[model samples]
Each structure stands twice: as C-alpha cells, then as structure tokens.
Target: MQFLQFFLCITVLLLYCNVSRSAFLCELNQANPFKVALTSTVDIAGKGNFTTIQSAVDSIPSGNTKWIRIQIFAGVYREKVTITYDKTCIFLDGAGSRETFIEWDGHERTNTSATFTSYAENLVVKGIGFKNTYNLGPKQNDLVPALAAEILGDKAAFYNCSFFGVQDTLWDVGGRHYFYQCYIQGGADFIFGKGQSFYEQSVLYYSLETYGQGTYIGYITAQGRDSADDPSGFVFKDCVILGKGKAYLGRAWKAFSRVIIANSKLSDIVVPVGWDAWQFVGHEDQLTYAEEDNSGPGADTSKRVPWQKKLSEGVKGNGHVKFKCPTFLKFKVKAMAVTLSDDEVSDNESDKTGLGFVKSIFVPETHSPNFVPSSKPPVSEIVKQAEVTPPRKIRVDL
Candidate 1:
C-alpha cells in the first residue's frame, strides 16, 4: 500500500509539473541580499512597476538575491496573494503587525481544489498582519482554513508580526524559520506544519470566542513529520500564554515529535497534564516535551501531573545565568526565574503567584521515585470534538 501511494504521488507531480510557469526553486540555503518596498494603494500595486506584490515578484531575478527589502506602507489589503521562489531573500517591512492586515478566508477542505502557495527563502516578514478566519466561530468548526502565510523556502523570519486565526495560522511547510516578538492568536493548533522553527518572546493568545470550554487553546509548538537531518520540531521561549479554556501547552502531533518551553508566563488556562501523546501513534515514548523555570497564575505544580518537568538549578551555568536546555526552553525559564525574584521586586508590588517573587525552582536534590507519568487525557480535544460529517473534499488551487 505504501508503494502504491508513492506511485500515485509521483504520477500527480508529473501531471502538474508543466501546468504553469513554475516558480524558480533556487537553493534556499544560499545567502543573498536584495531590497524592495510596497508603498502603493493601486489595484495591482507593484504588479507592473513598483505597484503590486505579484508584479515585484514577477520582476525578481530567478535566484536568491543577496538582500531584498520590501518596505510596505500601512494599509488593509483584502486580496489573496502568494510569493513565489523567484522572489527569494525578500524582506517585507510594514508599519506594524496591528497597522497592516492581509486577510482571506478560504479552506482547502471547504473550497476544494484551492492550491495553497508558499514564500521563498530568507523571507523576512517584519511588521505585518496575516490572518485567516475560516475556523473563527462560535462552535466546533470543521473548516481547516488555508494558511494566513505559508513559508515553503528556508531561513524565513518574522519579527514583530501578527498571525490571527483559529486553526493553523502560520504554516511552516519548508525549512529553518524563526519568529521574534510576534503575536499569534488562535484556538486549535495555531502553529502547525513541518519545520525547524523557533518562536521567542512571543505572545500566544487562545480565543474562546469560537468554542467556549470545548475549544482547544494554547500550543507553543507541535511537531508532526520527521525531517531527514534538520531539527524537525519547534522551540518556544519566553512566551506568554493566555486563554479561558483547558489547553495543553503542546502535544506530539506525530510520534518522535519534540517541543520545548521555558521561562514563560502561563495563565491558569494551561492544562495540568501539559503535554498530550496524540493517541500514541507510532513511537510513543520518543517524543520530547519539557519545561523549565516558569511563573504566573498557572505555574503551580503541586497538582500538575508527574510527566511534566520542573525547573532545576543543577542546570545552571555562567553564575546562575545559563540553563542546560535547548533553544526555546533554554533561556526563558532562567530569565523568568530571575525576573520573578522577590529580591528584584520593589517593596510596593504584591506577589500575585503567592509562590513569592523569587526564583524558587522545583528542582529535586535527589531523583524522586514517585515521579511517574500520569494517565490523564490531554486537554486539547479540538479535533476530537469536531464532528466533521460527510467528509469534505480538498480544494487544490494552483
């Protein structure tokens, strides 16, 4: 059956290979420098001559430029767009995430045959808003909307950007990516797809406007596919999670998945168990889920399940500055720990957590034998709650 499926995939690739002027697939690994800007309000701004995004893309050379800067003016764009590989090494700078908005509502499952597109390499998305509203509703929705922005090439970065939606918001369907000082709000698996990505100092908001208690909120990172050699997972650090429903910090979308969270403020919205096993699909025990120094209303660990990790001082380094964790989970825990210290707090401020404002990590001096993985169900049941009737057909818009 696997071989048959592979054959079918190859057949489809060949059939669609010559349908349109294929976007140049330059080696995304190469570093290029190019600069462009979007400062128009025309129907096809950068389309023909510095008017439309499509036009600017159509004019880019068929390779990764050294550096490309596309400065954009503040505006609300109501068009569905795609940036091809030819526009590699492109930098998009808008007024700000809140000031600039690019919105569309099209679901592949609902609008079957809509071929979702992608961006090129070194695509820096700074100060812009990308949103899709397919699943933004008041009930258990079945619509998996098309991505707000899809990055298919490598080394993509988004600084101070906002991705708004209720389902998959930022689809990292390609290479290494990073998001810094960004805001992503949704209810389900907001940040989904396959990529070696890192999200730092970002705010993840869970919306109850769609599915009240039944809604799935909070996902710092969720990994599904196992890429060949690259770090095929997600790392979230120094992030703030806020919502009003029971939501796991994250879960293994597929077996062998990995996710790390540290030094972040957690609201009571986070589930006690924290991580889900996704029904123990294939490699159940191989998934990596861990957390470090975190404080807030949701940082209480006494009632938390044993599977979740506690911050430790043993991993300290550089005179209490460094912690022995990877990427996203690395500095946030320690940073938050230091920042929450009572000694550092002013005498006028009250300790809200009641755990004191000092860095009192839950590190065990000795390995506790009672520490065991709990059997509680994961907090996120968005997919399970969705009774997708009469399975909708996928739309492949090319």
Candidate 2:
C-alpha cells in the first residue's frame, strides 16, 4: 500500500511538472506526440489537453497557418467563448450537436453577450450547439437580442451544428460563411447580419417564448444589405422552416436588405405577407427578399409581399436549384457538388451533371459562372419545360 501511494504521488507530480512546462499530455496517455501536436482534446473531466475550450484555443499561437483541431468532448460548457480575429485555421470538432453544448445566459448588450463569438477566419465548427440562455435561464426575460453565436470571420463553415436563442440568435456579421445541416432555433430577427452566407439543408425554428400569450409574432431575418450591390445577403437552400407562431420571412433592416429562400420547405407558421419593409417601408422595392422552388403549406406566393423577387427553376436533373454561385476569399471556390450514394444517382444522370458522379451543390452568395443566374429566363430561352429532367438529392462542396 505504501509503494502504491508513492507511485501515484510521483505520477501526479510528473503530470503537474510537464503541464507547467507546457509539454504534451500525450506523454502520460502514451499517445504519439505528433498527433497530439495537431489535435488538442478539450475534456472538461481533465483527461485531455485542457479542461476548457478556451484554454485549448489559447494554446495555439496567433496567426496560425496550419490546421489545428480542437476536439471538444461531450459536456455542457456554460461559459462565454470567443476566438479573436488573428486566431485562424481552427477546426472545432465536438462530439455531436446533441451531446456537446456551449451555453450561457448573458442579457447584456448583444455585442458583449453572444455565447460564442468567432472572429477567426478559415474556421470550421462541427457537431456543436451554442445556446444563449437569457430567456431560458433563471430570468425568462423580455424579448431582446440574445445572440447564440456571432460569426465575423471569412470562410467559416459549420456542419451538423445548432444555435439557440431568442431575438437575435445568429449574428452573421461579415465575410463569407456556410452553414450545413445545422439547426437555428429562435424568434424575432433570429438570423440577422450582413455577411454573405449560405445555409444548406438547415432548419430555422421559430419559438415565440418571449412574446406574450397569443402574440405569436416574429421575424426570422433582418438582412442589412445597404446598397444596390452590397454583395452580402442570406441564402437558404434546401432548408426547412418549421416552428410555432407566425412570422415574416424577413424585414429590411437596411435600405437594401437581401434574403433568399430557395428550394426549401416552409410550414404554415410562415406569414402570408412573407416579408416586411420595416424601417424601409416605402422603399420596399429595394428589399431583395426572394423565394423559389419551395414546398409546404406556407409556400403559397399569391399573398406574398409584392417586393419578393420570384426565382425560376433552371438547372435540371439535380434535386436542387441552380444558384448564382459565390466566390470565396483566398480560394476562388465555385459552389460544386459531390456524390452521396451510388444507388441514389444514376450513371446517365451523373454524366449529365458533367461530373461522372456528384451529389450536392454549394449554394451561392453572389455570382459564379459555373452556376446559372439567380433567375433563369423563360422556358423557351433555356429548355422546354417538358424536356427538363426531374431533381434528385446530391451532396455539395465549396
């Protein structure tokens, strides 16, 4: 018993010394140092690199060029997390959106209250859920801006993630961003910002919790495009909008607010007027809220706002709509498609897409020559309506 206690004490001392020296914890776990150098596991139980996500991030040097993966284990982290602008090329891999959660309940100014704020460019966050619990927390407060996550970086992508809040849920402030298979749950202008973003196969869930009983009114997006050619807008492709309460698709937060819901599913929760001019009331014509190829009970366009720009179904064969593809900074990547399942796609169909095999297509933010324009011309101008091939589901890439 004495020997065992001595050995345990020595082991603890060694771990402390190495950690204080900034040495890799892989020494104790018997893992390869090379792999440990690239991957920093953030386990709150203290079995990995650091006990907190912020510590794991702080370990990385500023202006990092190589990719560093921060493996966040399953846990409920109730802390505010921020990634500064200089800390780039970070890959935040969580256990799963349902398993790993970063939650906080700050009701302060929206600028200082986001649960997760990432200003680092070239960042990829996967399988994580960020929640701002201001309303859900002890206070069950009034309707105000409680941001879950704010992205102010370029080339940031999120996959299989989720955001939870009320009012201003996700502030996509600037730059080019992509959200894939993510869930955004909120009410009011939950998704408001000026970033050029593409939301693919995501779900926008509106919750009328903060509003008084039967007040069920909300606005999903408040895009802030300020000019005729701001090049920044919100595009939802192959997404689903289903939730409680009635809400407008968006309201012009600025002079030329722009938003598009294309090839998506909308529940009856969507208001018939669809969009609101808001502060830009008389200038509704300048608001660029558009919809195309959408299905579901709420997709009727007859009662839609007059300013809603209606798009056309141009591309054939893909279970998708052709977008005005975008160009990202650093990498002039064209929104392209990759293959999903062999049985799902046919060889002839594959050949027609020009890629022997492919799946989804990257949604556009602005313009790329590879994809058809936002709105295609008449049937006679492109192809006869009868000749157009049916659509199929495919995977997309940037």
Candidate 3:
C-alpha cells in the first residue's frame, strides 16, 4: 500500500512540474507575435507579406508548413478561394467576426456547372467570416457548392469562424474534423456533407424561405455518408440550433446517417419530429438521430416522427451501451472535456489544459448558456420573417 501511494505521489509531482514548464513556454511564445496590421499592409495599410489571400497561400510551403499563421485584417474578401492539400497547419486569425468577411454564394441544387475535384485537405480556416454574396447581384444560385471554403481533406479544424450561405453552407467533405466556437448559417440543407464532424460550442442559424402561399421552407443541417463502421459521426454537443420556418434539426440524406445531439439546446423552431429521412428512402433502419437530456419546445416526444426513436427507459437508456458501437445505442452522458486553445502546448499543459479536449462532462442540471432544449424556443430567437410583398423593383437596398 505504501509503495502504491509513493508511486502515485511521484507521478503527480512529475505531472505538475511538466505542466508548469509548458505554461511558461506558452507564455513566452504569446509574448511576441506578428500582428497583420503592424507587420504588413499587403491590402490594408501595413506592409505585410502579400496583398491577397491567395498570394499568401501561394507563398507558403506547399508540402508541410508547420504553424503557418496568417492574420487577416478586418475586410470583406469577395473571392472563391481554395486551400490546396499541401497547406497544413494554416491558421487564419481574424480581426473580429463582423469585421472580417469571406463572402461567396454557391448551392448544389441551384448550380450545376461549377466543377471542383475534391483533393484539398489538412487545413484550418479560423477566426474569420465566410459570407455568401452570390445572391446580392443579378447572378443568383449559379455557384454549386458555393462554399466560402470547402474542406475536402483530412484532419481539418475550424475554430472561431463563421460560415454564411444558403444551401450546402459547410461541406464536411473531409475526415475527422472539429469545429469549436464557430457560427454556421444556411438556408436549405446548408451544413450537409459526408465528412465525420464534431461541432462543439457552436452557433447554427437556419434561414426560412417562403414555400407557396402561407407555407414556409426550412433547412436540414447534416447528411452522413455511406459507411458501415464509419468511425465518424456528427456529434453536436453544447450547441445552439435556432432559425425560422419549422426547421428540423436534421434529415437523413443517406442511409447510416447518424447524429447525436446531447446536452444541447434546440429551439422551438425545430420540427417536433427532430429529423426526417429525405423523401423516405426506406433506410430509416440505419439512421440514428438521438438525444439525451436535451431541452426546448422542439424536444417534445409526443409529436416526434414515428421512425425517430425517443430512447425510452430500458437497456438502451441504462448507461451500459457504448457510443462507439455505431448502432442506435445510448451511453451514459460520458462527460469529456476537450480544451480549445489558440496554439499547441507542451505535454504538461496538454495534460492540464482543457484546450481542445473532448470530455463528456455533462450535468443535466447545468450546461453551457447556449445549450437549451429543442422543444423550447431558444433564447436567441430566430430572425422573424416579415410578410413578403410583391417585388416592385427597387434600385437601392432591395
């Protein structure tokens, strides 16, 4: 017993020492770094490395650039940009969410000509606004997959970023991605793709379009791909789902399209059924849309779709099932904390700092402020749609 106690004490001491050293090193790095404004005015007012985003991207090492930081000033960059696969560990630090805007407009349903071969991967577009400006002019919906940025590679992470679009806003067309503190907006099937994505502490906005007279159109956020042991699924934890026009949290576009919304807030705007199989493909058997201790007006089980499972009491809800099984199984709210930080840290801080760590530490009574029940109208109510009048051809600000 004494030996065990001694060993444990030594381990703790070593860990503490390692963590302290790491914190010191991180502080040292943060002490001085290049600010885009002070460093250069490639586009703004300073003398930075390059004027355009593409130029900066071209100048970087294509094969493997470690910790390549690009600070984007507060400006609306109106262009379609694609970060190639060779660009790795690219960090885009924005001035602020509203200040920085990367705007474009593309939709899969509307645009049939825009072509892209998906080979880009291993990138991080953080701390900026990705806006879709395609509908602002005479041109409308001509951009297919009009992604402000399309992540088609593996191991991508988008942090503190904003994705704005109508349809197919974010193509999770990659592998093992993590989105933290990001704001994603779309209209119809906006955030749909086959990539395995985990969105934590993010804000999701769905737009409501008119459907005939008195009817309104809604949006679907995700669509998983064809994979038996996908190992990748949509895990939305501590997120806010809000919008107008009877939006359902998801629609299974493909069989085995799985989503797990746990300890998150769902706005009343979400349809009572929570999810729908796109046009009833008959693969509802493989679809897994589930929730645990979720709140809101949209969370009422009485009106859920017949195919959707409410996870009633029994072996399923008994906290014995493993989340890794890929089946429509339930697990105890396995509380894990993934600490999100700006940069990498040493082993000590990696052990101590909760930055970018995924720990399922969910307490039903207490969750993040943005976390809410799907049945209840979210605190941040959806932008109310005003009654539309016949277009009278306005010249300015139509």
Candidate 4:
C-alpha cells in the first residue's frame, strides 16, 4: 500500500508539470497565433482591417510563418503598444516618423510607461515615431526616467523610426537588434540595456534640460554586459551623436559592459571625458568601451577615462562580433525614399489647400524621371497633421 501511494504521487506531479507547460505555451499562442499564409494586410485609420496598432497586432495568430504586414496611417496614436514573444515575422509600416506617432505618459516605476515594447522575433518597424511624454527636468520632485521604446527580442530591426523622451529613450534590452537611419532622443542613459545591437546611420540626440543636474548628468549609454564571455555588446557605425549640453559617450552599467562607436560623427555636446565609471571605479578596467575612425570635435580621446580602450585595427573590421542568427538576414531590405511631384497633385482646389500651396511653389525635377505624382496627400501634409505640445512636469519621490 505504501509503494502504491508513492507511485500515485509521482504520477500526479508529472501530470501537473506537463499541464502547466502546456498552459504557458497556450498563453503564448493566444498572444501570438500561427497563421496560414501572408495573404492578409491590416490597415489602421478606420479604413481597412483595424483601427489601432495594438488591435492589429493582437489579430495576428501565434507562431506566424509568413510576414504579417500592418500599415499605420498618418496620425498620432496616444497609446502603449506591445508585441509579444510569439508574434514573429511582423512588419509594422507607418506613413512617416513625423506623420505617424505613438505616444504615452509613463515614467520609471510605472507599470506601463513604455510607449512601445517589443518581445517578438523577426520584427520590423519603420517610418514611425514612439514617444514618452514624461519629461525629466527640475520641475520634477526627483529624477524619473521614461522609455520611449523597449526592444527585447532577437532579429528585430527599426528603420527611419524616431524615439523621443527625456531619459532612457531607447531601451535596447535583450536582443540582437539593428537600427538604421533612426533618430533617438533623450537626456540620461538614453540608449541602454543588455542587448547585442547594431546602430547604423542613426542619430542620437541629447536634451539640454537635464544638463548639469545632480545624478541626471547626460550619459548616452549604460550597457549592462555581466561578463566577458557574454556575447552582448552595442556597436554604433556610421552614426551621429548630436544635441544640447555636455554628455558622456557611455558609462559601464556592469563590470564587463562592452560598447563600440566606429566611423561615427560626434558633436561638441560630448564631454572631454568620453566614458564614466558609474560608481564602479576599480571595475572600470574590466569594461570594453572603444571607438575608432570617429570624427568631429567630440571624437578627441585625449581626456577620455584611463580605462577606456582604443580598439585595435584588426578588431575594427566587425569580424569578431556575431550579431544575430543567419536567418536574421531575411528581414533586411533596402530602404525606399518617397518623393512627391507636381504632376501627381490633384486638380481639386480644396485638395490643393494649406501646405499644398507651399509644396506647389517648390517642385523639383531631379526626383525620378518615371516619377508621377499621385492624388494621395504629400508627405508635408501628413507632417502638418502632427500636433506638437510642450513637455509636461510631473511630481515624484526621489
């Protein structure tokens, strides 16, 4: 009887484990389901399939095999959006960064503060702006950080997108991500996290409001690589660092944090001491902060931290870093430039009103010989639709 009871208990335990695992997988599937083919396209703007970006994202089935394309119209969507882990191969396209924006007002310690957060693999977001309205300045009781976008998935790429906030603007958390021709703005520890990421042809802008503040001194990055064996590092290539006030290139968030800025241009906003120890004085020697072939006034390394390294010639080739898996290349494509012409302008007087008059006055012929303007609204019209507001002040405890 004793032996039989023990056997029954073991069986029940195994069954419970299996059931829990299945339930977790089911939850993931519910968040992201498997689909048949890439025959459907979801449009946002009360026109096509969905009205909101999150609704369109939720509509996608789990373990999606083919690409799920979501086209967002020109407008400001005041909401937080998330792409869960199971939703793979998603292509989120927007009208333009200035034309289409996603905004929220969440600060650090807030449950849902990030304007956009992605935990899905093989995701591509282009031509959109993500912003957090939580400003970090003297008006606040304490320094409260806000994240515009938090990317936490592998093989994720953002092109021509803009991220705006005052602190922790772009959280490069846990991913092999690539950002091309994107603009990221923040004040302190703006580009941070444990991700192995590559930023190419992107702009990193710092805000002047947080300059000279106590602990909020402008620092662009705070990479958190725990050890030398970790394959996570941030590589900035052919990028530009610009904005107001003095700032450091980066600070070691972890002992083995690694960062590289190669073939980039830095404005005078950067401080002479390019890197910081970040309370880890002795451990600063273990960090791998390096720069090569960088130009502009801030590229001078004469006063950089003594522990900072100047990358060797052989290591500058980017041959040692394994960014992402081989299949990740399937999501890469040449960025397209959209141009408008006079011939494509509408003859209707009402359609040719407002900013259209300004566009009509300056029509350039250098665009494409085959380029024919369509009746669709011009890019400037979409940009004009965006409403700009002054930053808001919030109270918080230190």
Sort all candidates by lDDT, best to worst.
2, 4, 1, 3
* lDDT (C-alpha, whole model) for all candidates: 0.50, 0.66, 0.49, 0.61
lDDT of 3 by residue, 1-398 (tens): 00001111111122112132110000012223421112222344445666566666666665643345577787776555556666554555566556766664444443321112124443444566676655323454443445544666654556566766656667776455667666776666777776666776666776633322125556556676554434345777666676556677888767757666765667677877778788646767566666655667766657766665433333124532222211100112333222212222111223332222222211122111111112323322321211121111101010
Candidate 4: residue 189 lDDT (0-100) = 89
lDDT of 1 by residue, 204-250 (tens): 76653445445544554467644222235565666667654667777
- Provide the RMSD of all predictions against the true structure, rounded to 1 decimal: 16.8, 17.2, 12.7, 18.3
Best of the candidates, TM-score: 2
Error of 4 at 143 (Å): 3.8
Residue 101 displacement in candidate 4 (angstroms): 0.4
lDDT per residue as tens, model 4, 1-398: 00001111111121112122111111112223322133234344577677778988888887764556677888888888999988876777787777788988787563356889998866777678888876743555344677889888766777677888777888898856777667777888889998877787667777746545433458999998775445466878777787667789998888777777877778787899899888778876567777777888999988887777654333334533212221122322222111111222111333321111110001122110111112343222222222121222100000
Segments in model 3 whose C-alpha atoms lie over 4 Å from true places: 1-46, 106-121, 136-145, 209-214, 309-398
Which candidate number has the best lDDT?
Answer: 2
Note the clash tally of each candidate.
36, 7, 42, 5
Runs in model 4 deviating more than 4 A are: 1-36, 39-45, 108-111, 136-142, 208-216, 316-398
TM-score, one value per model: 0.64, 0.73, 0.65, 0.69
Better of 2 and 3 by TM-score: 2
Model 4 residue 283 lDDT? Answer: 73
Could you tell which candidate, 1 or 3, scores higher by TM-score?
3
Query: Candidate 2 — which residues are off by over 4 angstroms?
Result: 1-37, 137-139, 312-320, 324-332, 336-398
